[model samples]
Target: MKLIDHTPQSLADYTTAQVANLVPDGRHQALREAIGRHQDEALARTIACIDKVAAWRPGEFNYLHSSQYCQYLYYLANTIWVREKDAASATRLFLLNKALNGIDLFYEIAMPAHFFIGHSVGIVLAKATYGDYLVLYQNSTVGRHIDKIPTVGEGVIIYPNSAVIGASVVGDGCVVSQGARIVDRQVPPRSMAFTAPGGELALRPAPEDLLREYFRL
Candidate 1:
């Protein structure tokens, strides 16, 4: 697929409205300003990476042009946004931790304009619809099922190895525990979902008292 940088044209260029709404209005405006200057930074970094890649024999690096150069800038610029955006800041730190430690985050997928990378690495947010304040940890996945969209409510916590998919409605103030799998279902507000035998599931007040503390906030 051709990667087009439409951020300059419209907010829709980044991702869906759901994802964009996750970022605070103030922060979103800041991101807009930062993106306006992204081209310059991207060009510089792209040229450097190109030169480094070029040293690895012929055809290792794609030919660079003004358009391609801007595209490079767009990617890096998004990375910068990811680094600084709310919630996503944690994710960026996790990314740095993985990079410095030589861990692989190949499974991580982030849609453009989806802010809050807080606690990112080891997290796999695939083709899923996310709401605001979506706090996630390592090994979490919002997977896809037959092209259906999973709806996650605001202020939700998806812990390690927790998988929710198939048009499921993950309610507000919910905490999905480690190693749990929820599919094609609706989890109520202020609840915890756990995996039971025979592909069954259980819902109860989240094990952690702090899980619902923010509901009052």
Candidate 2:
């Protein structure tokens, strides 16, 4: 007997109105307000971000999966607008993110665009500065240790059940391996942090050698 695949078509085939329907009702009002506040060109840029995320999959698309990217888009836009002191619009998106994404990400957290939150459940991001293209998986944390917060660089991948805590600086092209813990240490760029023989943390140079398959290069 042959099995059949029942996956939905790619979201790239849908219209803007159809894509917008995937967002929750509560978020729609806030999204419209946020888009309205921006100029026409800026609005187009924001839509482009949404489209980019929507078209990520190679073939079939699922609304349940793609909707998370929409949540990320709102959260990123909210962070940018909040930095410009648009309190009302920012609050709306913040509330929407909390309600939809189930992540305890504060509005003060400086997460720029192109940051992906995979499995948003159990992920906590404090008031830390995040560079572009940061990918965070479930059960991973980025928070303060004492008075200092982490400064994460671009293209840093924090895998599941891992963390970068305190005033640590995670350099570009670094991968925090799953179940690894990095606290208050500067991880050099293009390196990998993993568990040593005695369960201690060790950094391996040139993570791309081992971790290239896990992240987008």
Candidate 3:
């Protein structure tokens, strides 16, 4: 994959500099080293992710791209946590992502490698069961209620301002439309969840394979 305006070493340096600038008091020498050690694996993971998104060119990564950078930061944090077991650096990366991207995706959250995001702003995800090809947009949320996390299946899209909460089951190929909320309810596969005229939940078959819009598959 081609990284625009960044070599491997330069991207690692840039990441360390960004994190250090955001948080000025950390012991960053080791953090820098850890990042260098794990950067290749993280970038590989990120390439696997963004390459599947239809909006981006398959073999190129633009560091200046907001959505791509957001995914890169996440992959780096996750790599540090899983490979180096360095929680401090991982937490810093997570906080830096939140500060820079306006999203709250913790380092511990397990996201699918091929999932796509329409926008990176105001998105929040809890420790939920997320499947492959998950699509999310701005202001979308998947949160837990009293430790009952949502189970979201593959090829699902959660639109802006929509939420799946409290043990909700969003089945395969479901679309939680804009402004819809599924709280403790089950949305069957290949269906669309939207707000009815009476402001209640409504389910109907999805008009098409919406994932085609975001993913190459």
Candidate 4:
């Protein structure tokens, strides 16, 4: 799917089809074509970032691995190239924009076949290993440091301002406290993770009963 091979007008039409499930607008096709014709030069840096991240994964080649990471970068690059104001890089962007306003789906990122989000903003997800029903609040980060990947279990609630870094596994039904920081550790299920003194981490019953509030059906 080389985008440059097609005419700018045709590329716009194709982009509309690709994102129609998220944003359905008859004029979006024309808008996309105009952006391609006018903004191709401006989107070069983002395109480079996408290409760089696409080939740098450590996992084996398979649908689960590639679709979750590599293909995401491809879609992200093209989406941002077409829409320059937003920083969203996946499906979450579309849903978020749809929720924020009645406007078309804008910028977002989300894994395929993942849990639903009623609303989202300011969320950052890294290339960490994740299980089902992973709910995240705004400003949460699942990231790495010194060549380590985080492993997140099912039904985890990462609250706002929380960060889970380095190699760690947050077990099922856990709640990471708002403004909490995690690094290089394994957390038990149904537990509460919070930040302790000296930037360390501690566990206790989640304040406000976060697990029951966010994870329970």
- Between prediction 3 and prediction 4, which has the larger lDDT? 3
What is the lDDT for 64 in model 3? Answer: 93
Per-model RMSD to reference: 16.1, 7.4, 0.9, 13.1
Model 3, span 1-217: residue lDDT tens: 9999999888888988988898888777777898988998898999998888998998899999988999889989998998878999998899989998889998888889888777989999998999999998999999999978899999999999999999899999999999999999999999999999999999999978678989998
Cα lDDT tens digits for candidate 4, 1-217: 1233454355445444545545564435444544455444423433332232323232222222322223323344435635654333334334423344322322333332233222244555666777765666666778878789898887677888888899988988788888998888889887799888877788985444443443223
Highest lDDT model number: 3
lDDT of 2 by residue, 1-217 (tens): 1101321122222312332555444444544544444423333434333434423442222345534444443544555475466665455545555556666776566566556666777788888888876777888899897898898888788889998899899998888899999899999998889989899999887545433343333
Each prediction's whole-model lDDT (CA): 0.52, 0.62, 0.91, 0.54
Question: Which prediction has the highest TM-score against the true structure?
Answer: 3
List where candidate 1 sits over 4 angstroms from the true fold: 1-36, 39-119, 197-199, 207-217
Clashing pairs in 2: none
**Per-residue lDDT tens digits of candidate 1, residues 18-78?**
2235544334444444544453443344444333232222222232232233224334434
Better of 1 and 4 by TM-score: 4
Candidate 4, which segments miss by more than 4 Å at Cα? 1-119, 197-199, 205-217
Any runs in candidate 2 off by more than 4 Å, and if so which? 1-35, 39-80, 209-217
- Sorted on lDDT, best first, the list reads 3, 2, 4, 1
Give candidate 2's whole-model lDDT: 0.62
Q: Which prediction has more favorable TM-score, 3 or 4?
A: 3
